[model samples]
Target: MRAGGFLIPVLLVLAGCKPEPEAPALALHPVPVQQRLPAQVSAPALESGRVSIRGDDALADVLSWTLPEASIEQPARARAAARRALAKGDLFETAESAIPLLLALRKAQPDNAQDARLLEKARAALLAQAWIALDAGEDLASLRYAQRHGTVLRTLWPALPEAKTYLDAVDRAGQAFELCVGGERALHAGNLDTSGGALELFRRAQALWPLQTRAQRGIAAVQAALLAGAQAQAAEGDFEGAYAELSRAGRVRSDAEAIATARQRIEATRTDRIRRLGDEGLMALADPAGLQIARERLAEILRIALPGSGAGVALRQRIDLVGHYGLFRPGQVFTDEMADGGRGPALSVLPRGGFSMGAPEDEEGASPDEQPQHPVRFERGFAMTRHEITVGQFRRFVTATGATPRATQRGHSLAYDARSGNFLRGSGIDWQSGYDGRPAGEDMPVIHVTARDAEAYAAWLSEQTGVHYRLPSEAEFEYALRAGGQTLYPWGVGAPPAGAGNLAGGKDVSTRGRSWSNAFPGYGDGWWGPAPVGRFAANAYGLYDMVGNVSEWVADCWHRGYRRAPSNGQAWVNPGCRTRMYRGSSWASAPAQARSAWRASGGVDATNARVGFRLVRQL
Candidate 1:
């Protein structure tokens, strides 16, 4: 009888409850056609029976809603009978009930005071009945019962404040009904946990009318479906999918014991599957050639197992330790035994650590290509040759494989022309040539070798030493060049410490008495060309000649910048690339080129004196 317990005189208008004006003369003017508009709040889904005033229950019937034919056409007689019916507690339930009968009488004689009084009495009875239904329970059926009475009052007499209140309540019931029905349809369509699925629909319905039986059942049914789906998913060894389904179920009822029970079941199944996968991975790891298969198994276990699970973590560690060719420690100096009863190049096990790989924008000599610095980490210890590979190492590849390098096959290579202060193609120059186109010492870093030549030497060394060997990735080169130094320069933010390595210097003059126009001030290595390998001091990582050496080809394609660069120290390469990256500064490189992040590229088939490469072995 009130809007949220406060009398609201104008609430009916807000609810769209404007009734027709009462007639002043005692004559039955038929109800207007517009006033007989069909009711929007149909009660077809309610249990109170066919409840439209349109007088037809056919599915497609669209006739206007109206009161029953005026029974007892005599106004005075109808008024007395309605009073008797009201005293007997007969209300809107029956055609002859006091509310409907009196409404018809008032229509025939709109100014009859006695009939109007009697109708108000019947409305009071109707309100009492609706209150009883409202207080009956929060179940869907009881709510619908109350809505049925509200519908009757709103249609025939909507001026009362109570009609607006009950009208709003009935509208909510209609919404709840629609939502529950949609939930049922989604359940049948197998849309369990997706957006707008059964779970979402049912939970929304419950919110509108808490514990309304139909909505409650819809929620329970969705939860059950989710739990069953989780079990089936786990049975198929898809533990992640199972956990996903269980999580969906928990959203429906977080404290439901069934969720915890299903989670436990899924966990047991997942643990067993992870153990079985670990065993298979271990078996694969036992084979000398099964590392790839073991890696695949490790990937699967990580997907299903919780983070840091013992089985998953242990298997990963074992896989990483498989190819420990030297069993060396970080910063440990060691060499693998070669098949020829010799030894591989001296190597320093670079420590496993992280470093900012590219130059910061604030660094004076930093270029746009080095903007957006990114971090790189080495997860496993790797062995990098302490210095560039020498002419002697490459000579062994040429003789054993009969592989003629590009420079040799072409009968010439790029060599520094001292007289012109430029590099020009030279005759009869090859990997065995020096920076001056003369026969090079075996200890000098090999010159006039293409990237393919470097890679070929690595392959030959791998066969000889029975260990993996390849050109270091650009990230690895930069990491070693930095050598735990985050300064702008490899040797710190000043001139390269004297005799640091072979670098273009202000104090050094060429054989023709030419000095570097853009060289480090107050510094010179006293060499007009690349010095013999490791001629200078080792970096903090205990590797020699990293900051200043012949610029070396690394195993990466020439990408424009650090965008989408690899975070780990792996090579970011593109297959069949024509331009490959070279890192570290050469003896001819300027001070700007000596920054740890500086890099350059040459054609894959390009061979020159200023560029050489070193080998890195897997540990």
Candidate 2:
């Protein structure tokens, strides 16, 4: 039967005429058509015929066959299909195929009301899909879908509320998402300055997306960072900086407990700092040199705005006291009597004032070393003994401390020899021995003591009285000697008045058969060697034996002249200095040598009957 079917087609082709066109072939099941066809029917010819037939009528047949029961010819069925696609979240297919088809059906079938309703339903489904994209956080996709189909839907159904509503929702979602992203970025960067702006963004985000958690957490993180930064600033002692950070945090979330705690810590730290500064100022009151530092600290405390508090008031008062009266005022004299032996010197206060140290060049007997006289000032006042340290006081020091005088250790000292009329080193003479080789009286000024011995005695005195006792500076010694007088002698410009001081005179010739080669000639108090302490009348400043009796050791390294002397009455000490300056003159000194500005320098370790020292108490 298959052979007869092929032969009929061949016989028809064998006729010299074209055969009539038959219906296009289609299969409901797979068939071996290639094998069943005539050999003359080439594969290309078969394929061409199949394509032609599909173009003619198989297209509709294939679509009807592939589509599930719905046909484009039926508008209601097509609209239903689009709805199903939208429901399944197939936005692309709904926009590209279903929406266009529904629009065409609505245009063609205007009178059919059901077709118009189905068309409207399909457009609504597209609008819903756009909103769905928005809900899924696909901002670009949502915007794209809306832009693609929104215009058509709006034009077709002017009263469809969801068209406008969905678009508005998309805009709000976009803004909220943008704000949330910005806030999170700022929080992650730890930018406190920009954190406030970021928080504003988060707040706006919450306004848009009321149920969003990211915006809320972003705001909390920013506030926490600000509070933590404030705490760190407080720990570093920057209260103002901390307050600024805290204020920003407060703006973000005003009711946070951490903010309140940080504020409290800042207040407590400020108070403690003020208190510490007050204590430091009080401690500084003990020393005049520390007044500057105290003032600085107190000024800082005052700037912190501690109102009407006792601590602030006390600090101000203390600062004022220091400013007005200084740590120690001038003209305030006191005495320190030792508790153990009741053997300490009377002290007189000298204020911070200016003076011209050394004598004028034109002054009589003024040496070149005393030339170029310069001005000096004292910033801090000190208390000085009224008289030179006496043999009795030195003896007490030696007995208490067991300190041996340099001369005593050497077993001899510089003594004035009556036979030779010259100062000669004598055996068995020490501080206990007078310049004449006789035992010194208890009240006599200590002689034959080196500078080291004087320093040791001053040290012991300081330990005994719990005061700072030391030798006077050269300028200090001169200032005390002048006692506000401008004369050659503390008594006057001329030779010392009778009984004014124990100077070289007729008394020396009569007692020791030796006298100054050029003596005052008319002046003679009494003693030829060393006189008792305070035997001479006190100077204008109540200091005794300032110009005579014996030269006093001063705390200054010997300089060639007043070339580089201190403008202040402070000691010019040189480390390992071998020579020390001694002011005033000895009992055997000539009248010119006894002048106030007649200075002499000697070996620091040299022991002589002429050298002695007085003590000063630093206040």
Candidate 3:
């Protein structure tokens, strides 16, 4: 007994020192395997749907110490997580999280009828949220949710037939939205096939939902855009543009208003094509000779049909003005009237003859070609303008012959100053101002005539006077100035003597006068503008202003070189009259231009304030 007592004490001490069996680890790192009710009625489905959680246990077990009512807070935490996913457009995550809480609710209260209804509502809400995600351009999230939840819903749908119908409708709406979204994406990427396919599906959805306002508008807008594109292609000459347009038009609903509008638009397009064809036909036949006729016809058509179309109207007017007045034609001419009506005893025999033409090589104003002097012989004679016809003379011609002046005359004329190249509205001279810059007189030369107008006046004179009145051939003009002599000028082989002619007032200054004294050069008078045509000594032929005053018109087409020029005194009429020749010089021009051999050409239709003319005829 004494030994047993000792052993018992030693055993007790040994047991106490043997780490106390670790006291079950003092429950410090203890984990209780307490039964965990599901977090909600649908926790199992949520877990199956792959919703990852921290631990595979009741949520209450993990957080029971933190909350007095851990079971109640469990549903709230699950809902919060689901809400977070939904807000991020994560449809799959939202549905997965929500399902667990639903399962937990069902598990914790299987006998409650309301639990089943709650689960159904939760499932429906998840589906609707998935549709929302699809609408938000989240295609991957939408597909994930639809694949997982759709199977469940479809299976659950049969039991709740009404819910099945709702889910089906939601699915259809989502599909329509997806097709439209896909079409826009493809269009952005320039993939025609994908975009067209999606657009067609979008149209089908519109048909399926006949009462949906947004769907109808969407379909209408696409149809209109498609038609516009096809029309643009048609304008670019694509024949298939018509078929594309028709296809787009066919997509419109068969309502009377829409059908009628489409038909009207189609008819309008055909009309535009007809008009364009006519214009192209005209342009195809465009040429210089027939330009006038073509322009008149086009103007008449537009005036009668397209009066309000701005471009068409402008083109129509432009064609008429440019073509009719811009070119010359055969049998056109001009003439002078005072010579026929007044003092020289009606010397209507306007003789034309060629002479040794060109200025002398030693002359101050001579050009090189004017040096290799040549002779030109006129086989015929033309009647010429007697004393340069005055402005009053032309007014009388206009009144007696009922001829229309080429340019419109008005009381208010354009006031132009070449010094500044500026214009303003001022009325210093009347339209009838004579070439001499004096008031209207019977003997002064006419002024303010375009070359075309002068030609027309000459033609009118020819008809009225019963003689062929026209401009002198260039050879005849120079011959008359020299009077059959090849001298430097009509007077002698030197510059003009004082009082011999009107020119710049100094020897060096050939364009303007410098001092107030009249002893500058030829004219000796400080006349800044034209004097009367007879104010200076006449040439050997008794013609006036061969070198100054106003230049004369000659009947040769302007050409740059005489390489292939005709040797006879006749007009050059080839190439359809691109330019008209002007001989002699104007008051505003330098004396160099006044040289007998100097020749220049200008547009036949252009008129200048400084330009005027004398006419000639065949005798």
Which candidate should be chosen as best, given lDDT against the real structure?
Answer: 1
Q: Total clashes, candidate 2? A: 0
Could you give candidate 2's per-residue lDDT for residues 99-194 as a string of tens digits?
Answer: 555555566676867766755665656776655555554233333344334334444453556655554444454445556655655544554335
Q: How many backbone clashes does candidate 1 have?
A: 0
Clashes of 3: 26
How well is each residue in 111-202 modelled by candidate 1, as lDDT tens digits?
Answer: 88888788777787888787677555344445446656765776776766666555554544444555666676676566766799877887
TM-score of each: 0.50, 0.48, 0.41
**What digit string (tens of lDDT, one per residue) describes model 3 on residues 263-305?**
4555455445534433332332233333555455565445334
Residue pairs of candidate 2 with colliding backbone atoms: none
Off by over 4 Å in 2: 1-333, 339-341, 506-508
lDDT of 1 at 202: 73
How many residue pairs clash (N, CA or C atoms closer than 3 angstroms) in each of the candidate models, in the order given?
Answer: 0, 0, 26
Between prediction 1 and prediction 2, the one with superior TM-score is 1
